[model samples]
Target: MLRQAQHERVHEGFAVEAVDLVKEFGETRAVDGVSLAVPSGSIFGLLGPNGAGKTTTLRILLGIIDPSSGTRRVLGHERPLEAAREVGYLPEERGLYPSMHARDAIAFVGALRGLPLREGRRRADELLEEHGLGEWARRPIRNLSKGMAQTVQLLGTIIHGPRLIVLDEPFSGLDAINQARLEELIRRQAREGATIIFSTHVIAHAERLCERIAIIAQGRVAFEGSVDEARGRLRPIVRLRTRSQDGSWRSAIPAAARLHNGEWVFELPEGGPEPLLKALIDGEAGIETLAIERPGLHDAFVAIAGDAAAEAMGHQEPSE
Candidate 1:
């Protein structure tokens, strides 16, 4: 609900809107009629498995590659190239030169993005120091671990404080502490009025980090919405793990999909969770450990994505 509301607010406010976007490399269609609305100053996640057209979409959005067909509006402008300078992109599968120092590597990246050499190094030193990597200032990138390299890459992306931040798998190789730090950074950036597009395969992290997510699978969006709405799509499954009355309590399993182990698990039909809870109590089974285990975004993702992949192989169109 918040994501949709944010989407509506952004549609009225921001200039970055992707409409029916399509991309192809040779004969293979990587992105198929994908449409997404990313509002400025919000954290939008583009999530999917490998080869789901996520990186390709970001590349197209960045003007690194042109879309086969479709349109994107950034800051009320149609030129993605001009709009690109307004963006900061941290790619997923890229590497720094092995011999370069961490700070130098980052400074070089910033320079390529139009930042002056002196200013780029200045910002790089501040960011590295801020992240407790002051000691790693002169350390070679080859000597740094994967997590440290990831931090350096992240710093490079934001040294210029671009209006929009596009991060591909920003959480990869990051420990819990760094992940939390990255989350904080994202929130801070959003508060500063910068739109952020974060791409990752880690669903739970995305669930916690993003206000809106466009889940792509097999070159298409499987589900696109807020976490709450994604969970709302699933039926409420009540797990009653109480002291079973001689296991005979399963006889009152609503005359449907019976009990799972000691807990009665069944999909909530109509109405909502209240009806299901009331029914469990009315079935003469005392609910000592009553909990409505709402299916997470993972369930929604698997269900939606699996269906989408099946449909794609079947030569069918995207399903709801």
Candidate 2:
């Protein structure tokens, strides 16, 4: 239990806080000293490759499983389940009774979260209709396609109007269309003042949806901060296409610059590009194309967590 003053300090503007959290299996440590602060009404992402302890950390935060060590507070409660009615959780492994109708399934989940059955059913119907699944409301869960069934489960997750929502790999198995829909839904929920924390191996989803993120790798936090800050780990890259193959203008290019498919690619210089641009012009380099590109989230992840982690994120390396 946290002291009143300490708890108040930690929860001032945060919906969830975990400190030095560690979860250990018999012979393995699944989560190693994970710490996170999720601000109220923010979309926070736990990003990592598979088996990186993201799920374990989330489960610990929600009090679904006791951590081997460390403390966590969710919605002002040290015991997260005490705030169950105000929190919604969508686990990685989705399940619904096959015999249950879609609406009933959603309402049942809401009821478990303390919503009245009648109101839950009403909200379930409204949600299904709004999400273009009204016709399937009465259909059995098993009767719906996988994507539709997943949608129903997602609707059920928020039927109780939770103040804090945790979704583990919410975009897994979703098609491009459904993935976009889920992203919009998440944004809407955050706009309405719900604090959301979702875990995903797909860095692209995190890059697109989250304002802040934590990158977990090998059961440890590799990095944690705002998305822009993550990208700032690497300098912007300068890619140039010039008419001349080799000339005095080449001296102006960074020594580390490499030729790749007819383009000179290198990190932007600390002094900026103006000097280099002037040098190139004076030397008649005939610059055809010049692009200074900021590092993307994928690049940042690779830099922070290594190539293996990037590969686990489902992105292929550029072929030579």
Candidate 3:
């Protein structure tokens, strides 16, 4: 499969491709007709609420489970496991031998993927030092903090120098500092020519790290494309707060405007903000604050996936 990929002449430049993939457990369909194409050397995100089948889709892509129907390719290999040596995966469920030393655990995982024990140990040492865990390298997993253990496990995932890295909910249990560090690491890896695919229910991470994203909801893909394109689905918003409730100035407000926390928030209508501002000023509306709000990924997600899915994911209402 590797050879075929090398000589196939047709280059879609895709690091991973899942076409109409489906997974079923009894009568329940976990992932239904999910299709994705992740570009090479890019950071991609699979975003959705809990039980949205993101894990199922990833498992199928990793060859951990077979799809009920459809096909997929990893690193251009039609058979995903055929490219196993070139891929690194960190599952949502994390585990490390409590008694094992941090460095040794990394080495062991590397060794399983055909990296020599000595070389693995050497790389583990460098990775630990680079990630600010130099003093904890030889510490037992049981003694390490949760953040440290997760870092070690991540180092293990990449110790073999895989070109493709897949992380499932990598930021779930991390503190803000650790999450920022992980985001930096992910960007660095992509800059070094590694394709990264991470799944998360938290939209913030995807907004910060991903160049391309897929929003999965209710066992299906709700949206897929560049972050800018997703946000483009909605128009710019205008939020205004006034010092007084003047009924005469109400005409300046668009019909779509909603009252929230003493503010009038609404999408800018056909004409821009200038006309509205002019009308408000002419009407002597005591404007306390007026600002144009760019629609964010969260707004796009709500628009694409619907309110129910957003609510299930605990996404705060836009006014918040």
Candidate 4:
């Protein structure tokens, strides 16, 4: 019994854990039985389409809003905000004061989290210089471009050096270059022992950064696991291009094969590539190209969450 309890604790050792969370506003249910266990010191992603309850779930986890049902623990405290001093949150809405200077803006936000003003200002200057905003430290936010303003706000969010950083749609309006920079920053924070939880409808960013992910659709979790686990749920795909596409080679094609741009493509059958190769050789298919490829996170998302949800992520703005 002691061994079993120890194993459970190891499995349940999470930076944030929510169980059967639900929220309703008026006649609409914003979240439905949502649950997640975000691993400590890991870059975890909450993924979904717009209006999919991702923001609501994050709010509940941060104690910004109460769930109608269920419970949660943040940083081992039964109450989510009990650990607020150790958490940093950047909401989807940008709220940097246009008239505030960049350095002062960071210092102000940090102060709200119990950081001393003098130290906040010092850290703000160092952070700005490190992130390539040194020359603009004194510029007012209103004078900065969209990307610059966004980066400054992100820096403010982390200025207090929280152990867990929660970001809601952090990449929503960033250009490609800025997005890349943000990705690097998130990774660096994780390396320094901070846990990062970010929500995004865009899958590519999560694919690049997160060690584990939860896919939400219509306010429900469709799947949650490591990237490798998600991809492993799909069979490898094979593409073949033969010298001829005649009736003689029909026997060589798998039952699931489909023709695309004059090439035959299909998910690998249960028996594996050896059987397929033998079939092609015996049939004299005269293959010009035979390629077997692993599926990616996008493919896994489509398979788990359906076309509509996948399309929402796939069509996310380049800025995202």
For candidate 2, lDDT tens digit of each residue in 260-304? 999999999887999889888988999999999999999999999
Model 1 Cα lDDT, one tens digit per residue, 1-320: 01212223333365468888899888999999888888667788987776789899888877788899998877667777786656778888868898999999888988887878787888888889988898998999999987788888888887776777899888876778778888887887776667889887777677887888888986787788887787778877766666546444454455686666766667755666666556556665567787767898777776777765434423421121
Residue 83 miss distance in model 1 (angstroms): 2.1
Q: In model 3, which range of ten residues has the least summed lDDT? A: 1-10
**Cα-based lDDT for every prediction:** 0.75, 0.88, 0.88, 0.87
> What's the CA error at residue 103 for candidate 4, in Å?
0.7
**Deviation in Å, model 3, residue 25 alpha carbon:** 1.6
Q: Is candidate 1 or candidate 3 better by TM-score?
A: 3
Q: Write the per-residue lDDT of candidate 3 for residues 75-132, one digit (tens) a residue.
A: 8788899889888899999999999999999999989888889988988999999899
Please report the candidate that would top TM-score against the real structure.
2
List candidate 4 stretches off by more than 4 Å: 1-12, 246-252
Question: With candidate 1 superimposed using the best TM-score fit, by how many Å does residue 98's alpha carbon deviate from the native?
Answer: 2.7
Residue pair clashes in candidate 4: none
lDDT of 4 by residue, 168-279 (tens): 9999888889999999999988877778999998888889999999999998989989999999999999999988667555765677789999788998888998988888
- Candidate 2 backbone collisions, by pair: none
